[model samples]
Target: MANIKSAKKRIKVTLVRTERNKAIRSKVKTAIKKVESAVAASDKQLAQANLKNAVVEITKAASKGVYHKNNASRKVARLSKAVDSINA
Candidate 1:
């Protein structure tokens, strides 16, 4: 219920940004899950590939401001550790 033009515009912009960020976050989560699942399956090739994909996705999310740099790094680190622990 923004009556002012500026306030209305701001609300619209915020909504658009939120939706875009949500999509990016969802994609990042899905990529991470795929990597984890591959690791759990103990498929070295798939795990390695998926890990690479997850890392890329996470880095991109960080760059895009969806996640803090350190937070994204931590997530990537954990995901990699999981994949590394899997026996091929």
Candidate 2:
């Protein structure tokens, strides 16, 4: 219950931002899961493909402030390591 008109607008903006952030986070999780599953299946090609997608999504999230830059870097590094291990 916002008494002021500005407060009401702020509430609406917050709601929209919340939904957008949730969608971004969901996409990041799904991308990570896809990479993990590909790794678990021991499919290097598939893993690499998924890793690429995951990295893109993660970096995008980071750029948008959904994730910290360091956090996104770590995720991409870990995924890359897993894919590398598959080849090694």
Candidate 3:
């Protein structure tokens, strides 16, 4: 328990931010999974569509500070590669 008024407020803020971040992370994970599943199924069109959505989600997450820019870029690169493999 926080004794000081500011400490209590800080605790509350931390809890709120944690929940928000968790939701955002879950969304990003879902987007990634969708792309992966499409790739695994060898559905080129579906994979391409899902890859676009995944990239958008990843970029948004990075912009929101939930993910580092390099990390997001890596994810996007990997997904793009997978989609490209399907094309080839």
Which predicted model would earn the best TM-score? 3
Which lDDT tens digits does candidate 3 get at residues 1-88? 8899999999999999999999999999999999999999999999999999999999999999999999999999999999999959
Q: Superpose all Cα atoms of candidate 2 onto the true structure and report the RMSD in Å to 1 decimal.
A: 0.9
- Estimate TM-scores for all models: 0.95, 0.95, 0.97
For residue 73, model 2's alpha carbon misses the true position, in angstroms, by 0.7
> After aligning candidate 1 to the native by TM-score, how far in Å is the CA of 65 from where it should be?
0.6
Clashes of each: 0, 0, 0
List the candidates ranked by TM-score, beginning with the highest: 3, 1, 2
Candidates sorted by lDDT, descending order?
Answer: 2, 3, 1
How many Å off is the CA of 17 in candidate 3?
A: 0.5
Per-residue lDDT over 45-79 for candidate 2, one digit per residue giving the tens place of the 0 to 100 score: 99999998999999999999999999999999999
Off by over 4 Å in 3: none
Q: Relative to the unseen true structure, what is the C-alpha lDDT of residue 35 in candidate 1, on a scale of 0 to 100?
A: 89
What are the per-model C-alpha RMSD values against the true structure?
1.2, 0.9, 0.7
lDDT, each prediction: 0.91, 0.95, 0.94
Q: Which TM-score value belongs to model 3?
A: 0.97
* 1-88: candidate 1 lDDT, tens digit per residue: 9899999999999999999999999999999989888877788889889889889989999999999999999999998888878862
Between the candidate structures 1 and 3, which one is better when assessed by lDDT?
3
